[model samples]
Target: LLPGDEEPEVDLGRLLQTVYERAAYDLRVRYEEEPVPPLEPPFAEWAATLLREKGYRRR
Candidate 1:
């Protein structure tokens, strides 16, 4: 789409609601009652690396 082209006005609440619904649906596809694959440590380390690379300081 060309910049400055007219676009439909958005309702932020509706947009956020749709995003939450989509995320929930995606989560259900991979969820399990039993323990699932561990992700916290890896994700945390990855996030830290990203933040550091971006020159963001941790509080």
Candidate 2:
């Protein structure tokens, strides 16, 4: 969903995946000597619910 893109539909899964990947990349850069931590489940559930609500709230 970059600026000026004309697609009317959004791919929510892709969007979330992109966000996770970017976050992981940032962590790797920030902690070059430490391994990136594994994602925890509660946060994942919260993110999914939040994204779902945001994506469908207008309907």
Q: All models: lDDT?
A: 0.62, 0.59
Could you tell me which residue pairs clash in candidate 2? none
Question: 12-55 in candidate 2: lDDT tens per residue?
Answer: 99998898797885454432232246437886556556655766
lDDT of 1 by residue, 1-59 (tens): 59998997999999997987978864564222222555588775675566557655342
Per-candidate TM-score against the hidden true structure: 0.31, 0.30
Model 1 gets an lDDT of: 0.62
Model 1 TM-score, all chains together? 0.31
**Clashes found in each candidate (C-alpha, N, C closer than 3 A):** 0, 0
Candidate 1 backbone collisions, by pair: none
Off by over 4 Å in 2: 1-7, 25-59
Estimate the Cα RMSD of every predicted model relative to the unseen true structure: 10.2, 13.3
Over the full model, what C-alpha lDDT does candidate 2 score relative to the true structure?
A: 0.59
**Deviation from truth (RMSD, Å), model 1:** 10.2
